[model samples]
Target: MASPVKLYVYDLSNGIARQMSLQLTGRQIDGIWHTSVVVFGKEIFYGQGISITNPGRSHHGRPLQIIDMGETALDEQTFTEYLHEIRQHYTADKYHLLDFNCNSFTNDCVGFLTGGSIPAWIKDLPTDFLSTPFGAALRPTIDAMYRRPTPGQIPAPSPRDPQSASSLLQSVANRAAGSSSTNGYLPTPAATPLQATASVASPLQLCTNPHTLNSLFRTHRAVTVFFTSQTCPPCKMVEPVFERLAEDKASEGVAFAKVDMGVGLGGEVARAWNVRVTPTFLFFLDGNKVHELKGVDAPELRTQVDLLIYQAFPPHPHTSLNLSSIRSISLDPILFPQVPAFQTAQSKLDGFIDASSSMDAKQKAKCKQTLASPVIPFLQSRFATKINPNIPQSRVHAVCSEWNKVTATLVDALPTAELFPIVDMWRLAILDEAVANWCATGSASGSSPIHMLLDKAVSAIASSDTTAVPRNFLLTTLRMLANGFSHVTLARTLIDGRSAATPNKTASTRQNLTSVLVATLLHTDAPVRTAAASVAFNVAAHCQKPLIDAQRNGRRGVSVKIDDAEGDWEVEMVSAVVEAIGRETQSEDVVHRLTASLAFILHLSPYYEVQLKPLLDVLQARVILLAKWKGGNGGLGEQGLSKKDVRRLVEEVARNLCP
Candidate 1:
């Protein structure tokens, strides 16, 4: 089901910016815009990091504009997972007012949910403000105010002004009605004293001693020093330029520093570097001075800074490719959240508990008691509605608590083979956010019930023949794992191999997941194949999301370093998925997902040419896909390879593997 998405737009200045922007920034700005994506009863915004609150309940209060961003096809669970994945990139420390702020987050979220962007005026306000001369002059002060700190704080909105949307609107109307009385003039807001700067050293450092300068050179990959004198007119002209460049290149591993030649120890440092003139720029690479430029030539200085960055950090070859199609791939994790009939699931599980000879009388009684608990009834009513905006969160926690207790008892007493029904019930319950979070984070003792249950299933599959494992049990396990992606923590636990209970069992968890994944991908049942494809797609999406984000950042001349742990399973997963693709000639949906997974693991991947490339070539992946493309329905009528979207995806994967 689709949910309507709304963009709540607030002005940081409340009503002050509209009135006083021209006087302050010399521009007729509407307001200092702030935006949040309001959907699923949550106002998701980025400020002190990505946060969620009841709609219109944030500290920013009511929005000045409520733009309808249309609808999102994602259900609450899937969308929550998407947010969990994206939250890593939008941390509090990474927030920037001009570059990556609240509006930036809204734009990204709106694009993900509705495939649309926020209105241009709200997003372009920063650029417009910076274009003005006054705004340009105030850029340093603005950066200092918004820059990340050991203890950074965005100034609180004024309490003297009413915070409600209606009150703010009324004040604006009152001002508009009385415009003629004051010749259309509005009072400028009183200036507040600037707060102390951040405890963390700025990228634009000030060095008064050789030791400090030498330490900076050793720490950063590339360093640029601006040697200036207070008495030099050219030095004054370029100081602001140097500071702006420092702000821009700070994230790129290049440090910028200013040395005042007329200040303490400045003369000694100048002579140490053999600087003959003020406004001299010295470029250092790997702690060695590589290039020098003199005078206040701003354009040349900019060029030299970029050149030094390039020399220190060469561009990844994948960044140069026009792989827009790959970049356009959806980063949303595929989840299977179908809830089964509670009565039916309970009856089936009771049958298993009754038939189990391994279970003693006490165990059987306890299991049946758990089945009769309020947890099942609560879940039945919880997912009864398509979108229950008013579902009591307290009720959710209560049900989750009951289930957690029962799960711990069942896992200890019952056999692994008979626990599919219990696992299935937990999977259905996980559709609720509270249950998902509980299962993801695990118990207070730091044990993951979901991980343990899934591990037992994997072991069962591994020990028994594929044909011997019950079809329903295998399907239930696959679906259970797929639904585990609902919470970001569980998603990480599954992919990154970090077990809550056994942190050292990282390799075991990863191997168990892959073992089950690879086994199920080739299962005889069509439903099992479909379920496996969804699981594969989720893992593949996880693998490629960081790479895709890096590619996007690269386009903006900023590089985001992905963790090595992110790609640890890429090569192995790709091999398993490609082999599954060759075998998946039956289901169109399965084939499409498999090919999409292949494209994801291959596209913009750092190991493409080095590792995955050779493996794909050896597998004859291009030939295999080409055969599928040619054989199916005369290239258009085939089931798996005939559809336009499927054909396009296969072609993309084939092209990626082309020698």
Candidate 2:
């Protein structure tokens, strides 16, 4: 279902990373969806997502969570945003196992967990968004565990190795092993137990217990003490506010601890500080009182209080630490920073990516070479920080948005089949990320620009020059479109509350679209057939009901499923075609289309599997249905045809069958 339709590639590479990505995107017979197969060099990185139930409850002696995502999803969206979030808490130097959605550890993640809510301000949310929190929490935990190398994963070369080949190499290896000093987790070298006291101390601080200080500093300055608490509502509000100042504005060596003064209040430490006010602000020098903010809550209170404390104790030594508690404080929330326009950058890029036929052989060769080195690598790095905390949400949006623009230029500029393999790969990658982002944020999101991406996919498929575009890319695009159409149909019904599912304004628009989708089911090209089969299945499965129902009720509402008494016409058509595909599976062309089409189904669905059943059964059902529509297989005076005529037609067709 991915752009290139990599089936045997998994068996080809042993690289751990590739193994991991493949595992995330594909599925095994046991029903696990392979999100990614991460390969670095020849060592493939892969992990199977197992769902753990009653997490602490043990069956044999192992901890577990249920691998719910393995069940199946209609499709996996681009996991770039997920990856960005993961990269921030952890690191991805080389050894990251990315799910196809770009999540490094999204084994069992799904709709609710992956994000499918509208903005918080919207009053009513779709009921489908119910499962987000459990999924979101599980994802982070999986990533944490995934980040932990296999028990005996060969140790990364030590950072302290003086003769190491490259500090850069060590950094890369350290990142692969999750040894990030900057991320929240501490970087502990192998074989070294954590020394809590020494570890918590500032780089220059000694491991001595409280009340101990260097004799050199003791003679120069006095230590200041400040008190705070975690539970105190006001205390919680001002915690970051105070930590920022303790390291910055204390103007002298400040030592502070947040006392728990709510349910468990007034501990021994409270008595020592002479607790008075709820947020009793204090200032001390040399363990002696200097001043007190009986009540200090003003704009930039840290500045006002520190100056007063300093004036009271002029003999103290130290300068402000200039700490940042928040990224940026705004006087007015309405006026925020703006994202820069990328028009100029786009123009430069556009010149390079112009249409394929216009370019010479030299240019085509350059385009192909650049696709791997620059375009592909960029996509890899761009999504590499799937879990990066450093990148802001807006910046992330900007990056994905720019990608769409760049891809548009590429599609507009280049148009050849040699580029087809990579083109479709990028196409699926972009759409996957887009869907993931859309579900996660409840906003229509994407890793690459959606419009540009569709343009490229469509262009490749429509290319008249056989050599200009890969037939595979065209077919793949068709499959993705089918699935995408179904997704949007569901989204519209659930998220937008709309009635129409397909492209046309009229319900009968199916006649035109259905023909287009079905033509590809018998595609001449192998990969083309594969791709076409997928899209045709999804589109027909979801949108064909109107045609089928129209045959019965003449545009009136028909109750097919229990709760969908008022459902649309397309559902019936999809159900009918599904029935059709199942019946025709014995034919090689039909079976290929039918089986490959399952990739776009709500994976693991009962109806999904039936989409590929042998043709005899389906042909039998079709004859019955046609008899009902035409009165009988043999024409009657009023009730119409009888079954005998239909049976005769089928026998003739079957006699001439390829088999």
Candidate 3:
């Protein structure tokens, strides 16, 4: 059976706490004291109010109640070490009378030991007192009496040194032996030893043995070894910076390790690596040394470490495809010119109302008003003209304002048939270079009238039920947005929003719009899938360019921060593209988009090769079969690509995986 953990409650004022509280708030309180966690008859406490001592008698009086806090998983020594780490941050010098006092320490210790917190009433007592009027008034006087001690008066406990494996094991053994003498409580049986794993959790692992160093290099895709010595001043200066870099790059499949040249096994490893300098950095890929840097240049060190990971996974060939070529492959907008069919439909509708058909007069009037409205003509004119980047900002605002009014009027009045045409017109408008440029340079506030109008129009149109609007209309709109996204400035404005940290209404709406587009790829329609793939491709291609360029230029990693959603957008887009390919493999347009998207993602970050390997393997096998069939005068498979293009794209991506 496991030993029960106990909470030792002590009254600091020796049971006169109610009188002290009455003076402060005119209310009797339970107690004004401190608390600690005691397990196996050892009294473990924190803060300046309580001293480290044996149980039964101490500066603070004996327990008012010894509440059992259930059993704990940690051994006594491990629990003590955990408390030591907490003490480094919550030292006596950093204590507060109310905010971070003795109670706070007890709460943290109890939670860590048994996975449960102390009673809420006790934990919240100080806060509750501070909330009251009289208690608040007496806070300052009370706080001054218990303020943290000045330096040299009561020295803070020193942090524990990083222990070696043997030393740590010995310490645990010593604690176990000492605990056997504790009163009444018996130590639990030793836990089964866990198998050693080469997963480094700290920002920097001090590798003192060849086995440990080898394990890290083998387990991780990329490892950076920092060779340093205790006597080297430069190494000390660069140590903190290197540790910070390790933390920043931890999620990027990079492992950081250090070896001290003055140490035993670390010295042997340093000699083997041919380290002539104290602050040498050796970057390893797949357990082999690939790059070496010597000296204490912090910026260069960060760049080289990032470069190591980048080199390990070189960009995909598709990522480097000419932007011009991608644009060429994209479908042109479905123009809605005033053709004979539209004219005939309008004439019939008018005649039907005039000849006293079943249609009501009011409905016919609405149809006539929608047809005669100058909105379509204005939209046509706007689409036809080349958007002048030199146009005054005010004039641009004026144009968008007029269009906003036109969209609102149409959305409120037009029936499904009438609205479909307007949606098509709006789709064409998004492709205009002038509109893209204007939106790119619009107000950073995200509250610009033009942006608001565009968001409202997109949400009103795209978010409507599928039965309410033509599916083709929604797909076409997505295609237009995808085409616009090819423009880097426009893509950034749409995806990242005005403020990267906090997304505004327009950004949130765009996120919703993007999610809708991604969801549409799962639809039964091939064309919808095709359009969604294009949107993903264009956005990924444009957004990933800067990150790829940064890596090429030997800069730190690039990140996208759009509201609460932060991560590698390149990876997300690649996955989405792969998913689309898996859903529908027969459409040529869809295949083209997926091919380009995969290439772009590979080009941007080759690290995703692990995640994309299965897809790549399937694609390669198909490409091989297709090439053999074409070469032997056989018919092409219905997998949506010509033999030549499929083979080339597949081969390009495969080249990046080569050693």
Candidate 4:
């Protein structure tokens, strides 16, 4: 049977709790009460500290309500671990009467267990109470009273006790601190137990053996060792401060560690590092010992550690350049020849909408009745026919125009599920036109009506709840734009400042397009990754083509003039493309697109040498290794590109560029 999760609410005052509510809100309420969650029949509560108490034994009156929070995914062990982590963060020092309190803890537990938060009404009670004049006046007294521990409350478990919850919590905390040992401190039984509540200390791995210590130096970007003995007075004084530094710099990829020289293997490791002093510090970069310090100098230790991190991973210095080849590229919407089936769908949709809008009260009622059944199904059949490739261009154009009109009307009218099929059908039609070479760049004067309609539809779908619109539909539409629409055209439209009539609007539209494409690159879906990579490839290829041509024609000094308004469009484009490539290097489905993108960057290397070095640096080793691999010679797999083809391309690019 599934474990039951219940929220036990209690009254926090003497007399009837309803009296206090009546005075505060002019209505009878259950009373101002503390809350706890009872999971598996054990009442767990968070206060000044986490504690367990007998059910209904506390001064806080009987629970006013027990909210059933449904079944939990957590088993006993996982639930214990969950509570341990909570204890680390929701410690006595961190608790606040108004903000971080029992209600907050309950909300967190419920969210973790069931993926659903506690009711807003219950969670917001404190805030609501505090907002009132009576609440504000009594805040000081209430806070002081809340901080006191109730009699007979069970103390938080001890970390020294092997079977206790604190030990479990400490083991978890030590891992975050970078310590790998189950017995984190020195194996000496006399060693003082580290407090469980001291989670703010930097992740310091307690090194018991040389192999573990050696691994830390190799795995981390940088490692700092705090060599100290239990007997050293100064070392003991500065230990907490050093821990604080470790915690602060943990995310910066620096591993902080401590070796207790008073005991066992730590003493041996300290001697190996030539530690003559009781407290010594060693800093390593890329597995090489780079710096050392002695004594309890906290400030110097912090400074040297900061310097080590900076040296390990220096910031990228972006270079600016203006390439005439990229400037000459066209920015226009790719317009495809209309399809007959699309026109039919559009015509039918227009008539239905017109009929619905123009109908009298009774007629409208009849139209509404038919909207889902006949009207929608008929539109779906008509739209699906647009995917037929045998249709003539002229007929296709007429159909596409009609379909575009119908889609615009259906954007707000149809449910997301119904609208997704139509949008996907439209995408397939665009993809078909792209394959046929019928889609070509149009005038840069204004946005394409079809593009605008599709964009509107996408915006509406994206803004809706995830349950309403399927993720695949969104990915497919994005993929369609990436494959069918030329990035060169889009980039040119964005950078072209000559059209002064509506620059702001033009820029906004271009930015929206760029934002969507960039965001799509980070999606977890493999198909979405492949499609987004294709879009990045197009953008990179277009930007690089001009530079390649300029170099080929021997016009080394020829530069394209860009207005300050265009700013770093070239840089941003390259960054986005490079980022996409970096993210998808290991993705099997996107190998072709990744290689194509890299090839463009390699081709443009001479023109944007300084700016493109980082891209080269990242891909150099992987490309060389992949190029040398003699993989199976298969024709295109499901992703439509052979591994052999990708390998050859990477080799060709590397051979020409790296040399």
Q: What are the lDDT figures for the candidates, one per model?
A: 0.67, 0.33, 0.53, 0.51
- Point out the worst 10-residue segment of candidate 4 by lDDT: 179-188
Winner by lDDT between candidate 2 and candidate 1 = 1
- lDDT tens digits by residue: candidate 1, 309-353: 888876766566666555666877677777777788788878877
How many residue pairs clash per model? 0, 93, 3, 14
Cα TM-score per model:
0.64, 0.29, 0.40, 0.34
- Choose the strongest candidate by lDDT: 1
Candidate 2 local distance difference test against the native: 0.33
| Ranked candidates, highest TM-score first | 1, 3, 4, 2
Task: Write down the TM-score for model 4.
Answer: 0.34
Q: Please give the RMSD of candidate 2 to the true structure.
A: 27.7
Predicted structure 3: lDDT: 0.53
Query: What CA RMSD would candidate 4 show?
Result: 21.8
Candidate 4 deviant stretches above 4 angstroms: 1-401, 414-418, 431-450, 453-469, 486-510, 546-567, 585-589, 605-607, 614-642, 652-659
* Residue pairs in candidate 3 whose N, alpha carbon or C atoms collide under 3 angstroms: 316-602, 316-603, 319-599
Candidate 2 C-alpha error for residue 109, in Å: 42
TM-score of 3: 0.40
Pick out the ten consecutive residues of candidate 2 with the lowest summed lDDT: 326-335
